[model samples]
Target: MRCPSRARRTRALLSALIVSVFAVFCGGEIASAQQEPSAPQPVSAVQLQSAIAKLGDLDYSARTNASRLVRRTPAAQAVPALIQAVSEHGDGYVRYRALVLLSGFNDPRAKDSMRESLTSPNDRLRAVAYSFFEHNPDRALIPQFVTAFDTEQGEFVRPAVARALAAAAAGDGVEVAAARQALIRDVARGEDFFRSSVIEALGDYKAAFALDAITSVAKLDGPLQDDAALALGKIGDKRALETLAAIQRTASRQTQPSIAAAICLLGVNCSSHESYLVETLKFTDRNAGYQELLRAAATGLGALGVAGHQEAAASLFDVGIPATEDSTRAPVALAVATIALRSTRLMMTLLEQYADREKAVALLAEGFDMLEEDLDKERFFAVARRTYWESDGASPRRVLMQTLIGTLDF
Candidate 1:
């Protein structure tokens, strides 16, 4: 070949120089030339400060964008700055937004900030703090919440405090007796504001010791009665089941569905009502009232365990798989999943019968998503895999299997 041109030689020299510089800076390991460069590390502190500052921007869009950005910050570095923003820098709405973002982080430091907010002169801040504790309850904070509820003078904050106390009390390792006494005292004080929440917490804690008290509430007429009945169902004690049955037997049309649902969820004998549940799925009018009934009945059937009820499964598949409406589709899919968990064979049968495998798989996926226990989820996945393999990668079924495999990884 002829001697390389001067331009080519110069280009070669510059390329070698760049590679050497890169190797020197990057610990002498030559990076892959084909690979894309890594993204720049977020300047956590600067980003946090900038986002906090934008919370007060006059434009609503700017404020919302800032809130979103602040929420995306690294929790480890953002907690301190967010606490400062909530405590010192922001107006009522800004502080509220900051506190909301702070709640997403599972940092112990955020607790102290929340506790401090309880004493702030601003009612809105106090309310937000209580709401945080309500949804993110801690077992260790039960006493503090109880004490706060007693001393909190503002009417607006009292309900929030009660809700927080209930949530905290529901946690394991809580002083159950003391928490129950506190809740009962408030209930007896006749403040209806937090009575339902307290009942819910009592059930959540499975405070079997409070069965008698909860039953007493369940006997009362009105909204509290329904709350108490649901709480009793959640408690799942023999007495609670009997109490729910009693409510179901005597409840008016308006209240019967809820009590029935409670009974089903408690794993009580709901065989007598199974027919009605199946019937609820058959209504095709799509009226709002019928939709609500469909959802409640479908969910109740799932809670009752749909393993042997081929009829129920058929009804759910008929309504749910083809359901274009979200309201009807969600409940029906959930019911199907619940049943499938108990009997994977039934789900496979339904899948085999349905002409549209993609829609069927999507529906099953929705149901699978509702499962909370890891073991149950894994079992569902195993069943789906078996179905996939048994079909020998056939069309329609193959599509379902592929979608299921993809979703499982996610």
Candidate 2:
């Protein structure tokens, strides 16, 4: 399976081209030289072909370049080079990139090479291999795809395989039933990656049976419960609505947010529990914004198709309690506030809370300087209006601006 010297070098050359191109694009002002060091360099295609023949000069940077080209280009000629780089190269990440690129090629030769990598001794490589298979959902490869699907320990791979299987199952595939069963198995176990992937795939396939899987996970613990709750909302097979109602009743307060989020996201109008959402916030001692929790709740309430969902927002206290950890806090604050603001009642509550909490209050006041959207400006203003802005010192406003933004969107 190792690539030949010639092919290996081609991959390296491809890598060099990519780096050069990126440098040229990124540092255009700097690279705009009056002359090339006032002298012409001597590099020819024949020498490049020879230099590329050797893999010794290739490194991860080069491999990265090769992978990107494989994804974008129409050249079938690059397939063999990429296949060798992935199969015989250093590290599974590089191999994974190669597999992704290989999927684009229509030739059986490359497809066969990709299939062979499905059994890569390295689990990372196997994970990438399955991703390609899942993305394609080719029935002819299901048996081979399944081998990796079942035994692969990599959570990363499982989601993609489940997705591919779910995608493929609805078609005239040999393993349509098996794919359905696998979806059940993953959801039932509360496996985080598989559960979400299956639920999402069900959305793509419109698999009503998949709702059972979502319901099953709603019963499990940890992330799947969260995922299952979201999936149920996404699927919107009304048959599961009764199950959703049941789960809403018995599930922990921790689970409520997800359930609410799911209902909201699905746009289903079945939420008789609108009062319950209002009631739930009062009882729960959770002070900080629970993101997954709020998302599940707001999204589910949205799904309930109830106009009164404005109540859920009113219950949100408009003034968001930011998590001490800015990473976790900001996104949750924005999302829940956005969902809650859908209702004027909720928006009023949020505005009131902003007026109430002093430090958190000040943060919302200055949020607009950093925030671009009118929606964010509105959310922050709602918080600012609810909480009193007491200026403590010069840094009071500065402290607020610091949390309002991050180096990047989390």
Candidate 3:
């Protein structure tokens, strides 16, 4: 090519440099544009307020969605708003939802609102507040619960207050003596509505001093008496065991099973009670008056099973097979499942009794649900699959097998 003029050559070089710079800048911009955005932080106060209000939405799904959103918000910003919603909200369900959401936040900032709700004149609010304490117990709030239990007069409030007291007492840094005394006073003199809760609280606290008071209540004939006997049994004291034995002897047939359950729970020598429990299982009559006794006996057998008593499992299996009474089958099946967890081979033995494969599969499904540990669930699933097989693709047993396998995956 012919030599260009110096100015023209300089201009061409400048133009090339400009193009190169432009290409580099554009490439950087394109790369920046292609990158993913960071997750968005929680929305502002106004948006959170909107979400809180949506909690009261007439549509159930909308309210549930709002709850999920509120739960994800930063605890510092969300706790106060949630507490206010629980305290000042007009809709009962919305307030209840707020209380439920507040439970997820471990922040102590929500305590004041919880205390306010605990003392609220509204029974439902008080109940939710107590339930909140159950999930998020604060040792500092123990005295407040004790005071609430002392003064709260509403029947609905009493049970909640009792539960709150129990939760707070169980926590560290609580004055055990004061909590025990408060529970005992309520069990002895509080209204009948509070009695069952206070009795249970005593058992949780293992208040040995309250033994005499609990024993006195165990003497009377009512649901409260059964609760008292159970409480004494949980205390696991020698005196408590002796008192339960006395109640077993003196109580009518209707009440004896509960006493027997208490005795069994105490880990006493329950051979006599075991015989009684097994006898109760032999009766196949579902409509008979002895149904309550049968349930109580089955419950006792399950307790024994928990203690790893092999005979209890055998007895439960005996009752579960050929259990014509639909009402009794659930308890018997549950007991067998409970024992089967301890003795894996016992499950196969129990399954063998049910000639009806469907019923056997149903009981296996129930057992799967009752097992809390994942390892145990997997073990059970493996055993169940190997035991039952369907050569036919259309077999209904396949459905049960699939369901059992799904539990392990979940």
For candidate 3, write residues 130-153 as lDDT tens digits. 766755676677778778777777
Off by over 4 Å in 1: 1-41, 44-47, 56-60, 131-143, 151-159, 170-176, 188-193, 270-410
Count of clashes, each model = 0, 43, 0
* Cα-based TM-score, every candidate: 0.58, 0.51, 0.57
Per-residue accuracy of model 1 over 1-410 as CA lDDT, tens digit each: 00111122223234434544654776854212121112112456777788888877886456755654554456667788888888888477678667766765557787887888878888767877777666566667677777776787775567567656766665355474566678877654555545655665565445666688878877767656655675676567876776777777776554555577566556665555666666656663255666545655665455444434565566676677766765676666666765666566766666667676566666665655443322234345544544554664446665555565553331
The local lDDT score (0 to 100) that residue 32 gets in candidate 2 is: 15
Query: Taking the tens digit of each residue's C-alpha lDDT, what string does model 2 give over 245-341?
Result: 7787887776776566565545554354555554443333254555434334433333332234444543443323533433233332333433332
Off by over 4 Å in 3: 1-81, 105-108, 134-143, 167-178, 221-223, 270-287, 294-410
lDDT of 1 at 166: 64
lDDT of 1: 0.60
Shift in Å, residue 12, candidate 2: 32
Q: Of the candidates numbered 1 and 2, which has the greater TM-score value? A: 1
